[model samples]
Target: GGRTPRIFKIMIKRVVVINMEEINRFLNGRGSISSNILTGIMVLNILIHNKPSKEHIKVGRVFYTNQGSRSLSGGVEAWQGYFQSIRPTPRKLMINVDLHATAFYESDSLVQLVVKILNKRSVDDLRRIHDRDRTKLEKCLKNLKIFVTHRGE
Candidate 1:
């Protein structure tokens, strides 16, 4: 099992040091948004959208979930998720959300996953994977995030 994560609370005093004239100009569409303001808004979006959730797995701006998972191919499954962001318009700010989908490896032993991916009946029948199959497996597992529990996380 994985260990529980610790949460820390921090208190920050906000000090408004932005130029009102520039902000007004940007809001009125007379000028472009400043880098500092954009950066601050992006950071705020990250903090707000990343609230802890036991039902979803967040990866950057996308939230992947098993709620509507569907078997795609072999050991891979398609997961439905969403991407959320805060966008500022000339008149007001809006929260933009959209649906997203991606493939995820099944949560199981690597050997089992390999068996499924290769369409094998059992691990005992496998001696070694062919070079072509190895390449295919590498492509499928590339950049896949994994959680290790053998060492107790």
Candidate 2:
């Protein structure tokens, strides 16, 4: 008697650009590759959520908990802001976490598999399956929240 919620499969690709000038300035000439990678990952995470623009791409310093050191952090936010400002409609972004990191390593292949799954079924078909498995999705979402919150604290 109840309507089913839609299950949309999402694929995300990220690009990271590091500013050497800003990094050197922030670190005062003391920086490492791990620091840079963590900074990039933070920026990517923020941009995916906020979606900035091109004009705001100038590099600057920002703090990140994961980096544990000073490094470049502000450019991606600026760029995402600029992009969002120009876009006619807001973009919806979703993130999928891979426990095994296999999706990160084999992104293209994993994306193709997702696409294939979606292409094989219509939206209505997915809704029917979701309706049949409502408890499963709800349980998974609940478990995910618990897992993330546990790690956060």
Candidate 3:
């Protein structure tokens, strides 16, 4: 069979360098943190603290609590388990995080969180997600805003 093959072009957009500080300021004000902001900060905190190098982090399944923080189990080792679960995720993929609090208990949230991390995103991307997820994303961004702008010693 000597049929001519048609070539298809696939374009991959280059990821520009993200200035975290500049992004923080543009999304929210310089000061103050609300409950939603707290949630946003928590989300960003997970992304920032888990791995010092961005390359090593994978925003896999993310979990969250609506009212309070997720409870830690089995001491520090749980964090190790947490990271292991999300390791297989690809380098950068945006995710929807309007998951209910119960999903955290089921370990699905970790997967979602990984999706958020690998994608290199801010709350603006939340525009494409569900309304509830967008609300949550906005709040988390607000929270992250406070942390980035703080002038504490």
Best by TM-score: 1
lDDT of 2 by residue, 1-153 (tens): 988999999998666566644444444434444666456446656675453233222223211121122222211111111111111112222343321100111112322323333443433444345443556444433422121233346
Give all candidates' CA lDDT scores: 0.76, 0.35, 0.39
Displacement of the residue 83 alpha carbon in candidate 2, Å = 23
Q: Can you write out model 1's per-residue Cα lDDT over 59-88, one digit (the tens) per residue?
A: 666888988799876898998898878777
Which regions of candidate 2 are displaced past 4 Å? Answer: 17-25, 29-153
What would you estimate as the lDDT of candidate 2?
0.35
Assess candidate 3 and give its TM-score to the true structure: 0.16
C-alpha TM-score for every candidate: 0.62, 0.18, 0.16
Relative to the unseen true structure, what is the C-alpha lDDT of residue 24 in candidate 3, on a scale of 0 to 100? 49
Query: Model 1 clash pairs?
Result: none
Query: Which residue pairs show collisions in model 2?
Result: 51-80, 52-79, 52-80, 52-81, 52-83, 53-79, 53-80, 53-81, 53-82, 53-83
Question: Listing every candidate in turn, what is its Cα RMSD in Å to the true structure after a full C-alpha superposition?
Answer: 5.4, 21.0, 23.0
Q: How should the candidates be ordered by lDDT, best one leading? A: 1, 3, 2
State which candidate has the highest lDDT.
1
lDDT string, candidate 3, 25-57, tens digits: 434555343444444545565675456344332
